[model samples]
Target: MISQLTHLNWFSVLCAFIPYFILGGLWFTVFFGNPYKTSLGKGNETLPNSPIFIAGPAICCLIITITTAMLIYALNVNTLSGALEFAMVAGIGYLVTNTVNIAINPNIPRPIFYSVISGTYHLVGITIVCIIIVAMK
Candidate 1:
């Protein structure tokens, strides 16, 4: 399957990267950062320092990108139909997320504004990635 994606064009590469970077950037930076930090029992202002701090997000984007690329390549999905499939997939993630939260952060509200914002952006990210691949095809 990796071999399949290797034949993708530069645009496909962008499809992989943009969603990961932009969505993760906005999600972590603006949406979930505050609440997530606090949930970890930290103050509102402490920021992660060190090279790992900066690189961690980049690594996340890379992973998501590669994974998305592979999904498209493997499933033979190609549709510029906007948010449908992505929303469904992300919705599935939310269910899994809720289940995991039940075990880990059971006291934390699923309705926490940051959780919603984080999931929403990630949803849009996957949507855009799927749309881009479909459009290119």
Candidate 2:
């Protein structure tokens, strides 16, 4: 693990990671904030500014980025097309399916709506991340 970490192209990883985080910010805020909240049965309440609330996602984002970076490296995705293909496969085969399972649970309201919105965001974000990683490589 340490040796692999030493060999990773940090800049490429950063390039891949930043866009995902930024896209998430815009996705859950400007684009689908109200609808997402409504799907969760939440009102227009001010979000807490606590560190866990603020930094938890950031930490999770970094973890996701690291995991994706490792996969890109491991898969030997040296070209833009390969990166995109891998991203699509990962997004659909893993991200979308898992999200759908959760979103479609009986307890969740407007399951399809939430699933579509969130799943699209993941797909787009991962695509952007893969493009950057490949471009930088």
List of clashing residue pairs for candidate 1? none
51: Cα error in model 1, Å: 2.1
Among all candidates shown, the one with the greatest lDDT? 2
Query: lDDT of candidate 2?
Result: 0.79
Tell me how candidate 1 scores on lDDT: 0.60
- Which 10 successive residues of model 1 have the least lDDT summed? 94-103
Model 2 clash number: 0
lDDT of 2 at 109: 78
RMSD of each: 3.9, 2.1
Highest TM-score: give the candidate number.
Answer: 2
Instruction: Write the residue-wise lDDT of candidate 1 on 1-137 in tens digits.
Output: 77866766657767667766776666766867776666445535777668886688677656665666666666666665433575357545753365345435555444354455555556666666666666775
- Model 2, 1-137: lDDT tens digits are 43556667798888777778888888887998888777766647655557785577667667767777778877778898898898899888877777788898777778888888888888998888788877776
